[model samples]
Each structure stands twice: as structure tokens, then as C-alpha cells.
Target: MYIIFIGTGWFSYVFSLVNLDIYFSKNHWDRYTNFAELSLHILCAIGIYIGRFLRFNSWSLVTQPKHFLSILPGELIGKFPLVVIVLTIAIIAGLYALCKPLVAKSSLYRE
Candidate 1:
């Protein structure tokens, strides 16, 4: 589990770098984005450590209770698209990782 999280975090970091290079070729690199990416990687690493030491499932979707009732509907509406994109990317990446070993084995057998 720790290995998986580290691998995923490293993969995500590399992917983000590639994306930044392609999309921000003409513009200066945004420090906030860099920080956010690094922080996320660290968070995953920490989560893996916690899971290993505390025997918790690190991949579980743990949500925090928020005061959504007090928040304006407009803010939630604006965040919907961003949430969708994040979830989509996460799902795609997870699927890719899950399939990678089988794909590699199949290619090796074919060759």
C-alpha cells in the first residue's frame, strides 16, 4: 500500500511536470500550482505511512462534515466542474495503474 501510494504520487508529480511544460511553455511557472502538487504528493506519502503504522485503509474515500447548508449555492455550482475533472483524472489514473501489470504481462507473453 505504501509502495502503491508512493508510486502513484511520483507518477502524478511527473505527469504534472509534463503538463506544465506543455501548457505553460510561454508563461512563467506558477508557484501555487507547484506547491499544491508537491503538497498532494506529500499528503499521499503521509497517508501511506499512517495506513501502514495504524492499519487503516489509505485508499478509502473519507469525507469531512462541512457546513454546506450555510454556504451559498453559487459557490457549489462553480465548483462542480472542477470536482468532476479531478474525479475523472483520479479514476483514469487509478484504472491505468490497475491495468498496467496485466498489460505488461500480456505484451511480454506476446513478444
Candidate 2:
């Protein structure tokens, strides 16, 4: 279930990025759009850590938001969580770079 959920997140994140490139940047990514995309990747990486290790789900964000937010800084303070987030960010950004062209090139279907 968690895998499925994360897959959804990845798909949504990718489409959001493509849309940003298309609409926000007028088909070309600007510095601000790139910044926003990278920031979101970092946030999602942190979210993955929180959900996996801390066992907080989407409901926790609504029901126990204060607790959730409170734990994050302390939890992410150490080297381990920092390493996880950084590595996750690298994976996400790296794959996105590799896949963006494939996504854009999917116009291979017959007209």
C-alpha cells in the first residue's frame, strides 16, 4: 500500500513538474521553476522519511499536524535523516531529468 501511495506521489510530482515547465515557464524552465521543483523534491523526500520511519500518514497531517510538525525538525536534525533526504532528492531529481524527455516524446502514437 505504501508502495502504491509513493508511486502515485511520483506520478503526480512528475506531471506537476512537466506542467510547470509547460505553463509556468512557457515551455522552458526558468530559474524560479527549477527552484520550486527542487524544493518540492526535497519536501517529498522528507515526507517519505516521515511516513516510512515516523509512521505518519496523510491523516496525521490533518489530525495531528502540530505533533507532526513538531517532530520533524528534531527527527531530521541528525545525520541519518539528512542523508536519507539528500539521497532521496538525488534519486528523484536524477530520474526526473532522465524521464522528462521520454515523457515529452510520447507522441509516438498514430495520428
lDDT of each: 0.48, 0.80
| Candidate 1: regions farther than 4 A off | 1-13, 20-29, 59-111
Candidate 2 lDDT, 1-111, residue by residue in tens: 999998777666676677776766664647688788898889889888999988899899799889988987898889898888899999989999987676656563111
Question: In order, how many clashes per candidate?
Answer: 0, 0
Give one digit per residue, the lDDT tens place, for model 1 in 1-111.
999997766655555544544454446655455554445544554444435433446334343214322332333354553455455456545654565445435533222
lDDT of 1 at 98: 64
**Clashes, model 2:** 0
Model 2 ranges off by over 4 Å: 1-9, 27-29, 108-111
Best candidate, lDDT? 2
Q: In candidate 2, residue 94 scores what lDDT?
A: 98
Give the Cα-based TM-score of candidate 2 against the true structure: 0.79
- The residue pairs that clash in candidate 1, if any, are none
Q: Pick the candidate with the highest TM-score.
A: 2
| Ten-residue stretch with the least lDDT total in model 1 | 64-73
